[model samples]
Target chain A: MIHQISVFLENRSGQLAEITHLLAENGIDIRAISIAETSDYGLARMIVNDAPKASAVLLEAGVILSMTPVCAVEVPDAPGGLAAFLQLLAEAEVDVEYMYSLFTHRAGRAYMVVRVSDETALTAHDIKLVGMDELGLK
Target chain B: MANYYQPEIETASYEQIRAWQNERLVKQVQHVWDNVPYYRQKMEEKGVTPADIQGVDDLHKLPFLCKDDLREAYPYGLMGKPLADCVRIQSTSGTTGRRVVAFYTQHDIDLWEDCCARAIVAAGGTKEDVVHVSYGYGLFTGGPGLNGGSHKVGCLTLPMSSGNTDRQLQFMTDLGSTILCCTPSYAAYLAETIHERGLKDQIKLKAGIFGAEAWSEDMRHDIEDSLGIKAYDIYGLTETSGPGVAFECEEQTGMHINEDHFIAEIIDPDTGEVLPEGSKGELVFTAITKEAFPLLRYRTRDICVLTRKKCSCGRTHIKMSKPMGRSDDMLIIRGVNVFPSQIETVLLQQGYTANYQIIVDRVNNSDTFEVMVEMNPDMFSDSLAKIADAEKELVGALKSMLGIAAKVKLVAPKSITRSEGKAVRVIDKRKI
Candidate 1:
């Protein structure tokens, strides 16, 4: 299952670089990342190659990290793919908390990682649940 | 000759002061090296010894003690004496994690009481007056520090820790409290409360000693005008023996450092280099007389200017201006340095109630700062646009004051949570 890991980061220049450097140093490849911030600090949500290992690495480095399950859907790069998925989730009574589009690899196909309440509803919609291995993250 | 209470030792000449400090410095260095392994190792690493510290000028030869040093030595790491000698333990509430505890021997407590008594006397408090101590008690050092000092001054002291404003006022009126001790914000609220209840005449408060938080001159004037009392500022930290390290005399110009007990220094916050007396820098203190946990060059992080110019009050002790703000309290909002006191200054200047909250959130990788201010009942109305305009005006004022754009939301009176003790004014939702 796609897991959303919140990496607590101080709001400073090159803070992202420091975090990314730590992740790279630990060989924890970030599949997708999005940043949410407040004035003093920020939360960086990451879909990593190894959620548990990345969490441990971050924690050992004295970085506060929180894990939440997110649904990763393989959608076509064509227009309205996200809207359709969101509409489907809405109709299924699964409220999306937050989401971010994962970077595309191939010429046409794209994917999005969404944090939602009901993972069961997302899995039931024939939305293939992408894991670290499935995305060749590691 | 000065008054008997104002001892020459307390306000010794600079040359004599240096000699006294150097003597204690030598003793303290040897005491720590022989007893506290932590200090011994640190000194060994830096190749520093008791002989190297010849005077106060050579203080930089010793390492500066930060708050982290205290945390690392948690529970009782910093104690220079055996645990049996410690009579009291006071701590700062660790909103982050573990509280920083400082042990005080009975002798240490007496010294602390004497310093606080000096503060009371500096504020012109007398034995005939009733002293109301409103500093929060328990692990916090503010309450007991002042309470003991009030008793030492032979005043009828009310050890009313904090909260229960109604009872605070009732006692103020019933007992005729002439001296009030509390954080400046609470003093302002108390003034407002007395006016609200029409008990202005019933209260007998004439002077206030406010500290434990950084406040501005405007705030001092606000509290003084509202409460019909002279407000004096005091300065100290739990590590340095609580709220009696320095105090404002009747002149209210600056807080006079009790140089006999604590050697005061101004150092660059980042570099720790000692600055000139008139320059603004972080204040550091070395406890010369404290027995149990005598801190040497404890960095206070408070940004203020120190002056040796003789005050009109005739006290020869070096005076420090009211702290502008703490280096640690500087909040980085959207790449801009913002201090909560700046927001407070703006709010007070705008004629709005101080019951406000600063909310920070991240939106699209950018920091968003929002200030929510509670409308005073007298100025509130049902008109939405008018209220919004008022909020916009406040936002504009804050932007000007802090040099950062902030969104201001005017909330209904009583909407902002009222704290009986220390108010929680800053909410960084971004951290979540």
Candidate 2:
């Protein structure tokens, strides 16, 4: 299990840029970023190099955020890797709320974080689950 | 014991106050009948002569005067004394309808100042304290009214007359201002500025007299907490003299009306029938002692209740509850009387900013009530479900407070345009 930072972004042009700028100013690198938006607001989720440090800095800068627990898994850097992971989840009836790819790959192994109802089924299937420290992220 | 500007009148028995009202109201009726032909015409149209009004009880026999009548009697029609005797004229902001010019003679100004002196005294002000008057000066009554009252109280009066925040701060700190006089919003702004500038220690304000606008009790405590001073609300209209008509005592419950000068009554806004004491209705005043502009049965349009309940402050003058809202500002959404203050109270209790906008419109033959609040960082949430929960909670609380459900929308912080003077709180788009 790894931590992901989700920020509430008002549907304004510079809101996301402001948050990202503050993150860069604090030397916290965003490993991956995805934005899901509605008409009036957006929820921007990020996998950062330093989740804890980034959370503290963003919070101190008055950004509204929540630290969500997600399963980080390393799969073969091939198209069927994601398909195989989805098939495993389907067999276990695991509900995936959302999933996004990590920016960095290690030795041709792509990393993806999945927010799910329960991750015990994936671990039961002996899937490769990675954490921030295991992936050598700060 | 409460400090009083005039003990004889301030603590006068009900009988004494009644006698003064009886004697003065009768003379005032005749004063208007003879001097202000507009009021005389109104009295005659109601088929009531000066001979018909003998005392305060006969007040209802006289016709009620509304703002429309005042607007119709524009420049000088409402003047009871000629320009020769009039020493000063203070006008209303006239944001709602038309600007009303109220004239005051030397004696009128003296009495009005005396009323303000009582307010200052009630707020724990003393001659030794430096009183700062920030209410707008020239045409607006707040500045001049409090200025005169501060003089009567013998406080070192700083006639700041609003604006120039830096100068206000310099004077406040350097002069050691003890009492602040301004609208509630300005007081809040000043408090915010003080904290932002980190000048809290230099601030010497012990008490604040805030008025000329509607504010909630929640806003009162906020100002008090921020400024480290007790905030008192003063209620008045430019029509019935100005900011010192009724003022809050240390009791912190209600404002004691200066019954010796003006007679107050509550009346059903629609039927024009005087409601019994303690009934919430549109406030009506008869300036029995005002020389230049004597208004008879002048409807204040502020909806408030009067209480004869014994006050610990020991002032015998009747106390008027803080007005719920001016009758004109009251919104009837689906037949429920909803005040913006009610929504404000709910918002503050839910840890939101006091600055909010209420938008009302009509659709499909029904009224739609919606409140737009800024999404401050503290109350923001990342989850859509959590954000929806926040909105739902606000809607539920507003429904309970307003007796009608209002849709709550959270926009970006500081999105609504706040005016230079007076933040626009309500927008009614109904063409009705």
Best candidate according to lDDT? 2
Q: How well is candidate 2 docked (DockQ)?
A: 0.21
C-alpha RMSD (angstroms) for model 1? 15.6
Best by DockQ: 2
Whole-model lDDT, candidate 2? 0.85
Per-residue lDDT of candidate 2, residues B360-415 (tens digit): 87653346778888777667654676777777898888776665688887776667
Tell me the TM-score of chain B in each candidate: 0.77, 0.78
Q: Write the per-residue lDDT of candidate 1 for residues B1-432, one digit (tens) a residue.
A: 232245675566878877878888778777887777777778788899877887777888888888778879887778888999888899764422335789999999998999899888777777887999998888778899999998988999998888899899889999999999987767877888888899988888889998876566777887888888999999888889899899988788889888878888899888888988799999989887888897888887778899999777777789988876566865555424466777887898888878788887754324678887765534432223344566678888888776568887655344566578566787765431
Model 2, docking class: incorrect
What's model 1's lDDT at B115?
89
Candidate 2: lDDT of B264?
Answer: 93
